[model samples]
Target: MIKLENASYSFKKGFSLSNIDLTIDDGEFVFLIGPTGSGKTTMLRLIYMNILPDSGVVRVGKYSSNSIKKRKIPQLRRSIGMISQDYHLLADRNLFENVALPLHVIGYSKSDMGDLVIEMIEEVGLTGKENHLPDELSGGEQQRACLARALIKDPDIILADEPTGNLDPVTAFDLVKLLEKVNAEGTTVFMASHNYSLIKSRNHRIVEIHGGKLRS
Candidate 1:
């Protein structure tokens, strides 16, 4: 579960997130829509404990921004998956190595890591491109690779920040469909996007944020 109670944050430039309150139960897929600089990314960062609110509290599962220790932040992040517009893959790494990165951080055995990495790569339809570099993949394929990296750890919730912003419309739709498939498998999905057309036909909860304030 994720909850924000009267949470507010401020930036040095006068932009701020107001007293935001929200609740997302386990296994729910929620869409967050907003324009550029509308705090969509800020909200996700808060959920993952990248930054804490200056006032009030933000909670995810058993972790709370109010009292969580810095040392424990990494442990909290392990349970959450994150994807973004820019595919944050290492340029020097191959697809298999990139996908296996998280497993190494979490201390998985080499034998187990290879099977898990291959399984996730296949799940994202990148089965034959394990040796390829991120630069060699198309925009959509790169995004899928990012998705595979995010899912390899089997996180409880996925926080996608404009994941399809760089893709064509058709590719964008396909990516959302893939996310839907993942959600159906019982993982919660919280995606932030500005593409209304890509999501209007879908049946899911839509939460709108404008000027850092959520719309009722």
Candidate 2:
């Protein structure tokens, strides 16, 4: 779960987020819809403690921005999954290696790492493409690989920023359906997207932010 209590963050004199109070509960799929430069990314960063709030509190699971230690950020991040528009796959690394990176970072056992990575890849429907590099896959397949990488750790929450941004309409819809399946499996999902039309028909909680403040 994630919660922000009157959280505020400022980048400069005029552009900043102010008094944001939001909550994302366990197993919920919440869509964050906003215009460009509306602070959606800032809000996601705050939830994951990538950046601290200027004031107020941000609570992601047990870690609180108000008091969490710097050294514990990695541990906090391990409990949360992150996906982005660009896929962020390592071009030189194949799907298996890319998705296994997180497990390697945490020093997971070799056998466990293999099992988890393969399971995640299959979950995201990239089972047969384990040895393929990023460029070898289509846009949707690449994004699916990104999703596998994010899910490999079995994180409690998934924060996706414009996850379907680069795909064609049909592919984007398929990707969202995969996200829905992930949510159905009990992982909480909070996705930020600028294209309202892409997500408008989904029966999920939609929160809008404008001018650095929550509009709904």
The most accurate candidate by TM-score is 1
lDDT of each: 0.94, 0.93
Error of model 1, residue 174, in angstroms? 0.8
Q: Count backbone overlaps in model 1.
A: 0
Report the backbone clash tally of model 2.
0
Per-residue alpha-carbon lDDT of model 2 for 1-216, expressed as tens digits?
899999999996678999999999999999999998999999999988999999999999999998899999999999898999988999999999999999998889888788888888888888899999999999999999999888888899999999988999999999999999999999999999998988999999999999899987
Model 2 spans with C-alpha error above 4 angstroms: none
Residue lDDT tens for model 1, 95-183? 99999998998999999899889999999999999999999999999999999999999999999999999999999999999999999
Worst 10 residues of 1 by lDDT: 193-202
